[model samples]
Target: MTRSVSALKGQDTQLNCLFQFPPEQTYNRSVWFIHKGKEHESCLTDEPPLHITINYTERFSLAANIKNGSCTLGIRSITISDERRYCFRFYTNENRWTDKGGVTLRVKATPVISELYLKEPPNEGITNNITCKVSNVYPRESLNIALCADIVPKNETLSEQREPDLTFNVIKTVVFTPSKFHHQKYCTCNVTHSALQQPLLKTVIIEFQYNSNIAVGVGITTILLLFIIIIVLLYCYKQTKGKGKAMSMSSTLPTNNAAHSENAVEAPSQESQTEGNIVNEHFEEPGLVYSEVEFSQKEKQNNKPNEDQQMHMTEYSSVAFRKY
Candidate 1:
């Protein structure tokens, strides 16, 4: 086996083996074996007509010439499963030999920064997790993932192992406490791999939001509660005032009824007395009186009488009195 090689997946690579023996000895045949976990599997047997295993029949090829004393194994469109150590064994005439130090082929794939976003809604005064996802990376141990907030490192890296494809999905998370000062700030995700010439980076703007709707809802609820309390107080006051007025009116009702009865009885008596006085004034009659008197000789000397009417006559007088 030649020197070890680091090859990218989905590319072509070759392994060469060279050996020297005595001039009398001639090269017979060679076989290549791949190292599995605890065993080795024969991949190709290079005899006269180079034969390969069922798995490598399509994409595996070999070129060898005893004159050049070299055998090269070619692989096309390498996959992650092709990452293993390959050993070469050969038999020359009567001697069998094998190369113990096999060639190690390391397959790698570039890391792709697929997404960088917040795992939860960013609310002011709360802690949130920002996640960065990297996909399709091979040789998971070679992946270097990081998260940054404004160029400051704050990250915890985790990876998910996938089967059959031998690829990995990496997740990196950062803890952030949102505040008014952090609005519109940026967070970056960086990924590096042996297959990549430069680090893959993804930047996202973090926007923290205020919980104004919740505050408004709480305020409205408080106002409604206060208004209900005021209305209840007013209703209770009105009911109390009405009850007091009712008690006062009930206490005064008997006095008012007695005074009304007394006035009703006295009104008829006064009207009847006035009518009796008018009748007495209309029926009253006038009165008359008469009196007789004699005069002496002294009263005749002081009085003068007509000489023509002085013949013999009797003295008489009449008087009247008024009735009221």
Candidate 2:
């Protein structure tokens, strides 16, 4: 039977071959590798006796468990250079030998998958993008990449890419419209490859934010604005009140100044008049004399002379006494 084995680097696999011999004899077996008809690697002699070599350099090792002319070769820690066809040949001490079919090793690169995340976290009932990035994938034909969501019944393809290294990458996306109904649903990425034993998966839970926190934030902001307005109004009112008080004080100063000026003028005139009257009354005898007494004691005391007549008499007495 013809068979081929595919594996990733740093993995192990079995290469089994069977043969028939006539009788029990000391048998020597060796596994030889060929790539494109060119000999590249070899494992010579018995079970663990041969050091596995590639390009004449020791690079890998294999162990064979032989029972009843059948062998199972265990290849350990396979590498990319180990990709080739290996065949087993057995030689008996009786000069009987045979070379038979074997396994073709096809080493493939491993697929790398990124985390699944929401494209936009803060979106409403509008559809948002969910994405996962996969890289470094080989054997593109058998690779299966997809996006999965519980809310929707379909898997969507967002994008795909191929690197210059001939390795393909995929960008899978799911268009999801979130509402309050889907507040805690989840999305996942499904990656399956021929080289992987189990499917690689990544998941992200969807979160739909309600406006209660936003409403609370707005309420707090409005209250702060009102408080600031109140403070500004109080400041303006105090400023206006202070200006009004200053204006009133300034206005009253002129009135007080005018009243003081009137009093000053009237005071000096009254003093001069009183002095003149005393001078006129005393000039009649060159001694002390009461100006009011000039009215006379025989006249009506309660009905004394008018103020104009008394003043006239004071002036007349002064002039008359001077003539005397």
Candidate 3:
């Protein structure tokens, strides 16, 4: 069993003393702490409060505050030379006992993001791997690499080795598939140790796939434009066909009207000619009368005829008489 604390230079830190005892033990108790071969012991007879005297070092300053159920010792700034082991002792009503071992307080330098590589920018429906390397760190187990809001890969593997400067280099790898829901995700690497009250953290920005609104908008706009183009083409085709039909009807109507006008002009002349022949027959004496129509002159008249028939060569007619 081992207890240890890690801290950075110029930072405050604490050693823990959480004592577990039997329920029956009471009335006679004592607690003490030993550091650098010096012991700060308490006496129950004198009613002196339990406390520890620290062997002050060049890196750690005065104690700021004692906290955590009076189990933790607080230090002001810590430095390189302050690295050492601390021991806690206890006594019950029966006898005295010590911890299995002791707490080792390590003064560590701040961790750094030494290297980072993204296999590729996040692509939808595809898995992406992120490799992060942390360097110049001590007590490598305290380093944490995670995604935003506890979205860490369950299978993440952490590996480390020592560097030439005696500091450690830690590597953490994560694998995940990107989604439209995670448009602007952040990946953070953190280190928490006895050196500082707050965890030291570094965050990396990453993103590639577009979110819901942008993706939806682009799809809808494309469909709308295609629909409009099809409608316009159909309208143009209908207009062209309509103009062709109108022109065909207009051309046929004028030829029909002209034929009807020529028939109207010839209709009056035919009626007048039939009426004259009837009058001449009524005025003649009763007899079998016959007449011949010929062109005596070589310069003959051009015939005026209806479109249905033609008058050519010679014509002969017979008149029949009846008693009135």
* lDDT of candidates 1 onward, in order: 0.67, 0.62, 0.58
The pairs that clash in candidate 3 are 7-195, 8-195, 11-78
Error of 2 at 111 (Å): 4.9
- Candidate 1, 1-324: lDDT as tens digits: 234788888889887767777789887866676644233433333322232221336677665674577867778889998887776677889886766666778898877887888987788766677888888888888888768646332335565758567888877777767777778887778788888998888888887787778778989999999999999999999999999999999999999999866744222222222111111112234453333234454545563444322211211121223443
lDDT of 1 at 184: 84
Q: Write the per-residue lDDT of candidate 3 for residues 11-30, one digit (tens) a residue.
A: 77767667656667652432
**Which portions of model 1 show Cα errors greater than 4 Å?**
36-56, 64-67, 151-159, 214-324
Candidate 1 lDDT trough over 10 residues, lowest sum: 272-281
In candidate 3, how many Å is residue 227 off? 10
147-258 per-residue lDDT for model 2 (tens digits) = 7546673346756677765567877777666677667776678899887889998887777875666668989999999999999999999999999999989988988998
Residue 186 lDDT, candidate 1, scale 0-100: 78
Q: What is the lDDT of residue 191 in candidate 2?
A: 91
Candidate 2 wrongly placed segments (more than 4 Å): 6-8, 18-31, 35-56, 61-74, 88-100, 106-112, 125-127, 135-139, 151-155, 158-168, 176-182, 193-200, 209-324
Give the range where candidate 3 is weakest over 10 consecutive residues by summed lDDT.
Answer: 310-319
- Candidate 3's displacement at residue 96, Å, is 27
Best by TM-score: 1
Candidates 1 and 2 compared by TM-score, better number: 1
Tell me, by lDDT, which candidate is best. 1
**Candidate 3, superposed: residue stretches over 4 Å from native:** 1-107, 150-155, 209-255, 258-324
